[model samples]
Target: MLKTESLPVLMLMGPTASGKTQLAMDLYDSFPIEIISVDSALIYQGMDIGTAKPTSAEQAAYPHHLIDILSPSETYSAAEFVTDARKLIKDTHHKGKIPLLVGGTMLYFKALLEGLSPLPKADEHLRAQILEKALEQGWPALHGFLKQVDPKTAQRLHENDGQRISRALEVYYLTDKPLSLLQEEKGPCWDYPTLQFALLPEDRGWLHERIARRFELMLEQGFIAEVESLMRRGDLSIDMPSMRSVGYRQAWEYLEGKCDKETFIFKGIAATRQLAKRQITWLRSWQGARLIDCQRSQSLSQRVILDLRSQIEKYPIFM
Candidate 1:
């Protein structure tokens, strides 16, 4: 049996359609590892087809934690993810298994690794007021206001990204402190030994092709019907976080007559590629993460397992 203290938390990160799920399953078959999903979309129930969530049979064979635990209407933040992941990591360790956190959500990984700033909680009144001002002056105007107060963060975010822009302004409104300064003050909370791996395709063109193909396959697999089912419920809207997921957003817009069929497919594929691009950018910024070329000829699972064994051998607790 492997010693509990010798096992490290394994983080498997990659862009969408980079074969992260397949590699994670291979690792699960080869080792005593429990999976904790790190994806934002997978947490919501009934968001299966669009999110490309694990099938019922796959989930049955290899149970994953923190997936399908929330309704689409409910909100989940990076802070909540940190709390849930930390608890799951401890639990998995106690059960003599290494926690294998797998997904493409870089924000969650960052929050779990580096602790969040002690910013004040979301204020509904303030949020509403901001939204009202945004409706009148537009998000770009609000972004300009943010640039005056927190230029560092404003430079990092896009003018169209209302969610983050509002949050940064909210922090300034509540605490009179820049969001960047608060984030810098906080230290990493997770001190345990961790082995981080990122799956990156050497050829960017090849990865883009893969993303387009995968999205087409999703549409063939009743993706539009899935979105229609959610829409018929009347409780969900395109503005909601769940519906705002890349492919889902395009599909929702198409169904609402905002776009034509051809445009919908093109937009969906383009959005997925953009999401992958953003994920790759985040992975590049991460320090000390081992990069796995997804295009390699050798079996990725075997290579990863061998690396894990080597790491275990060097661990002091194993000696």
Candidate 2:
């Protein structure tokens, strides 16, 4: 049996389309590490094209944990991710390998690295009801509604943040308590050393251009047909967390005849850009993570491998 000892975990974080997966594959070829996907979208089955999921061949060769582990109809939580990832990390270490978590899901990364505050589970029915109310009344009006029940949370979240607002309301209704108050309680923290790295885009224009191109490619890859098959399942709705994902949401609306194909493409690209922007903003405030300007990095594989070798040697993980 492997002795109980400190093992370093490696994380490669970046916004979508920042070449994270390619770089990760290169690193995997050289390193003794097991990959655990940190992406929320990749957890669902039948969500390949739009989620930019690795191909069957790639997955077969690479063997990522936590991909396609759940149907899109079910929901996942950051707490659950922490639990699952901790186990995977331990399991990998037991085999004398490092755990290399790779993806753009910063929320999962945060939950794993710094831990989370306990909160009530999501009630889809309540979420749909809250969202229906928001549709009838503008998000600001719903923000006002949230203000009455959870003033602290409302103040923290912008009036235009419909998703968070709806979630806060759902929590309040479910537990008959304020979401803000619940968030004040502490939760479990990870007990391992970690070396976190991020591929940050220094050129906004380049990242935006990449997003546009990737969106177009996804369309060519039959993103619509993928969503169409999910719709045919007769168990999904637009409000489900799975369908609410960036490209999938727009395609769902387009198939429902709410918008033309051209408009759908425009909106899909715009939404993806917004998601990338949010991810970049979040990464900017993160502390202690080595940032790589992927837009300008040269011989990225060599540089990153050297850095990892030097750093992981300190932990004696890959030594």
Candidate 3:
């Protein structure tokens, strides 16, 4: 009843605790689409509770890809995700199914959508030297260094965004090239005709309240204990990407005795709120994304399904 030419790949994106998983499952029930996770943390093994990974039953019913595909000890990069995701998309299409990319990591979405810029791989020696300098000279000096070299990028990043600022400075210091230049040089390629959706609440306070409640739930769900297991592994350092996760970082502090249990939960909630704020800021910049308002809806899940149904009807994936 419909043409295959108009069946665009769908990307369902949202912040953590914004019901992306629920919405994706609802869509899965009605459509022949495989859920491909876009979250960075969900890729790791033994990180189920904190990451809010799908249960065995849910995954079995839905057939999600890119979850529990690796261990926390193994580092998975955005480059690898893009490569694997592209392969999955092609393979799924070949099998007469659509690919539905879903999750919270905006960078992963950017990697798949715009294509990765050809920046040199991180130089460990240079990164270490930069880290040492920052540790000795403080984060402000790193920010000043970045300002001197790549002022445009510096202006966009805040002084307190020490991680990104330090990384940007290190890249320039190592390669004598601005990271922005790499992005600009590699023009964006639309890899797929994509339909994007974001689940959001019209009221900010409602979403914030949801975030607070969810953080409480994570604590009850033994989030700290999960992080304890990872710390005991003795493989992760502060420099590792895994250390930068929301609840994981707080739990690390608790393990170090830098913060108590209360502080851990408090800081985790605060950090999650900050993360949601950043996600909202990024989502606003997305082009042509259909935003479903979750506020004032008695059944948020049903609303999402109806929206997806409308989109699928307009651009049917199966001919």
**How badly does each model clash, as a count of residue pairs?**
0, 0, 0
What is the per-residue lDDT of model 3 for residues 157-235, given as tens digits with 9 covering 90 to 100? 9887878987788778767898777667654465567888887778888888988898788778888788888888888
Q: Provide TM-scores for the models.
A: 0.83, 0.83, 0.79
Worst 10 residues of 1 by lDDT: 310-319
Model 2 misplacement above 4 A: 1-5, 123-182, 315-317
Compared with the true structure, what per-residue lDDT tens digits does model 2 show for residues 191-273?
67788888988888899999999989998898899999999999999999999999999999999999999999999999999
Off by over 4 Å in 3: 1-7, 126-181, 314-319
lDDT of 1: 0.89
lDDT of 1 by residue, 42-75 (tens): 9999899888899999999989999999988888
Candidate 1 residue pairs in clash (backbone atoms < 3 Å): none
All candidates in order of lDDT, best leading: 1, 2, 3
lDDT of 3: 0.80
Residue 156 in model 2: lDDT? 93
Best of the two (1, 3) by TM-score:
1
- Pairs that collide in candidate 2 are none
Q: What shift in Å separates residue 44 of candidate 1 from its native position after superposition?
A: 0.9
RMSD from true fold, candidate 3 = 5.0
